[model samples]
Target: MKPAKDWHAAPLPADEAKRLRQLRSLALLDTPQEEVFDRVTRVAAELLQAPIALVSLVDEHRQWFKSRVGLDVCETARDVSFCAHAVHSESLLLVEDAHADARFAGNPLVTGAPHIRFYAGVPLRSSGGLVLGTLCAIDTRPRKLTPAKQAALCDLAATVEREIVQREAARETLEVQEVERRKLRVSESRFHTIFQRTPTGKAIVGLDGRFVEVNPKLCEITGYSADELMHMTFQEITVGADLPADLELVAELLDGRRTTYSFEKRYRRRDGGTVWIDLSVALIHDDEGKPMHFVSTMQDISGRKHSEEVLRGYRQELERRVLERTRELTSSRTALQTITDNLPVLIAHVDADLRYRFNNQVYRDVFGVEPSSLHGTTVRETIGAAAFEHCLPYFARVLAGERVAHEGIVYEGAPNRMWNATYVPEFQRGEVAGFYIMSQDITETKQRENQMRSEVMLDALTGLPNRRALAEQLALSIDAARDAEVPFALFFMDLDGFKNVNDQHGHDAGDALLRQVAARLKKTTRADDLVCRLAGDEFVLLARGITSTSACSRIAQDICRAIARPFEVGQSEARLGTSVGIAMCAGGTQTSAEAILAEADRAMYEAKRKGRNGFRFASLLAEVAPAINNLVDRGSATRH
Candidate 1:
């Protein structure tokens, strides 16, 4: 055996600092063995026909096994780990005869216990492109991995990566949800404090407009005790002129036509004198869709109203001053128009009748209409049917004196655009006269969010739906099957002898084979059937609306046959078969996606146990949880 030359003193990767951070983020260092990870290592060892397999995570000073199929020790020093070197490699690091390799010939791992002879490793890369560790197979006897076996090893490694990424995503989602929940709690606390302690009159009224409960400030404002206020309706205290209009709004609320209404009105105090108040009321509903109560807040505005009346007595002098003020207002209007026209957002005003009163230049630029010509035109006529319909409900709420904010897609011009719009009620003499509209183009932002979502749900290598997407599709299929009262089948397939192709020809050839296989699987399935690459050589097909178990068996057979055909990659032709297991959901039955997939997985292993290149079907009624008693022969399944 050649003496090892500074193998323990190998230089760190260039991105070592960033890589360590990425590894730590997974929170998996020194973690106990998990079945999900252990299964991958077990499969790797069985398929590579190696005695030992490990899901190794390389830490700063040691290599820890998240899963160990044959090794006794839970971890080893980084200096002697074959995985340390393998993590730095982009492709599989294979040492057919470790004693012949200078790097490991005299290493402690090779010279001491276990006496490692053969090794093949594929780096476990995080979604962010950092190499965290490796999924490796080792043997006590010297042996080379066929190209197909190498590919199978790589596939197993990819599965480990998928598990890591999915866990990370789920953790992040939980963190975000926790933050939102905390914020909600804080907001509720603040709202409660304000509602109880604010100086404004606050009360809860029944559907009859009579106070059901009143705060201290409300009693002070009405010159009555809380007990007295509870007996008197708002209509009884309101002056005659404002009473009828307020009652009409209450009627709208009762009919569920409006959520809120605000207005200024006079209330006759206990002393028989009138006081003006600005009042806002919102309807609350019970869980069973019944009107529960209304929340009302009122601010005394008697001083301001009195001052306005005093100024009205000087009408002649006020009229003379108004002439000068009108000129100043014109200049201010011009300045405001200049600002609005230069802004990137669309700004406009529409009356209660939905007629456009005014709009900025940006409106014309986006909608391709003359801003001046929009005056007195109905919104439906100006923006066409699609955009108008999108805004109609919000428009109704705003015209009813409620503020509305929403996001929607506007399909106009060459391509559709996303927008965020806000509508605020405009008041004339304390009544809703119109609404001011502001909309910002959010197309770029929306597209970026969609792209991120797509990337998260797709497999970067094979361009197939990843496990996350498969789970979602399976859930949808389950729902559809239950709704339509029909049966559906899930097929779990593992490629036979894919590792040999990776071992002989190279990982590039292995990748090409996977992509080709994915394409073939997609082509073989019906358009409505979902085909997903779960991880590595494993793929899942969801056959929705299947009629019977016989149909599922035939589909599974067809897939196995299709995959048995030789794959042409460049100058080489590699052949691989499939072991398929199918699970069917009966009509009108309730079953979760996880339950169905688990059944299919069990059946697939049954096929592998029986022999490669065949199909097996298992129903929900079958006993699917039994452990495998023997390992399948890896050499029997091969790529040319």
Candidate 2:
């Protein structure tokens, strides 16, 4: 205790004192006794051998005890405490005795409870030169301190300052650690949310390949429960074929070659089917930068895989078919070219514009040009307008889908060659793409045609000339038949019940039966006989100059037997019979060979009406014809 001059009065700068009070107010004053505070107080008390020691904080109104040994309740009023004076003074304050020193003689602490008589206090300074407070010791009896003890106390106060600094550093470190811990908690929450909510399956894996975490999506993809998956390694669930590749990718991630790796793999389900998955793997590192675990994301890609495979197969198949078609088309094109080149007839094709699109070698040769030069050349340009006009009407009719056929001579360009030409329409996509023209050089055919026209008599079935060569012949019959006249057969026969045959069987069967009969008749006839298929199985035979009727009868009877045979019509058996009518010019009264053929045709029907399968005489038809068309032209009359 001391008698103080006005307590706030001090020799320090007013602002410095205010700042020092602020510094001291920041809890250098009267704190709870702890190791940091007590260590300094205890050392000072022991070295000084005083009854009490204190590290005090002096505020404007009170001296507060920061650390004290042997002091009670931690504080005293500023007016009564000697340490308050030590705080304002930069140097030490010492009082030998309050009773003996007039300055503290009237202090209540010396006259009242826990009276202090001897006191010494040294000012404690902060690093900023603020007087924080004092390190002071007290005695109930007047005492003196040794110099060493005094110095030791000052050193102990400096140690307390250093302890405050160290304690502050510890507190800052604890706050930093707390903040880091909170960040870790937030990051963990975020990671968990992402793992569960992502569309793909995600997992953490141990180095031993066990799952540390497997999301619901992972469970679904693998077709395993979470509990089941937890007991199995990824190797056991992955398809065997995909395991090796997966291992390689995992190795890359674990080796730090990549932080993340991705690949497509298959996972085998419990039912033994496999699901395709796209896997992305990443390595997680520990604080020390060592591999801690693997994190993987799996995406189901079965649909995509199947689509790609199917599309790839379709593409490959389409390419194969395309190649096959191209090869076939090429072969067909080459064959068509060969056939066209070798054909004797001229062939040409023209487009919508009447320009030659394609033409055979004959056409090119007839026009006196290379085949290639004819392409895209109009008929008028290539052959002059006169030839084009002659062909234009046929072209127009063909373009209108009308089939135009004409047999007349026309002179082509280049050497004035004449041809009998015909044009056909070629359709594409239901429209006429072009015209196809064929022409034959008829310069020699015309001569043959003229010679054929001179002989008016012809085989009724085959439309070839028949044996009118006898009377119309200016030479011997045999020579006239062979060279002077194109003598052919007029075989006269009747189909027995030909009407009933058509009725009993269907028309299709009857027609088929007739065609078969005609084929057999053609086979039986002479190769040069000109076998004619007449209507309703009535055939004529001009057995020209037969050596005898016996030979002709044998031939006719053989044909009759041939017609009596069985035939197979579709799904049924059929039988046919015939009657023969013999007609020949072997010195008969008929003047011309036509008279004999007319008689035989009439006699054949008569044999059919008479009990069939029997031959009849020519006199019967001559008798019937007079009543029928009266101009029967009996000039070459029939003789019976």
Q: Pick by lDDT: which candidate is best?
A: 1
Per-residue lDDT of model 1, residues 235-314, tens digit only: 88899999988999889878855556778999888888888999988777665667799999998989978876874454
**Candidate 2 least-lDDT 10 residues:** 631-640
lDDT of each: 0.79, 0.66
For model 2, residues 31-89, the per-residue Cα lDDT tens digits are 56777778778887777788798888767677788788987867877777777666655
Best by TM-score: 1
Runs with alpha carbons beyond 4 Å of true place in candidate 1: 1-333, 411-415, 484-486, 621-640
Query: How accurate locally is residue 177 in candidate 2, as Cα lDDT from 0 to 100?
Result: 88
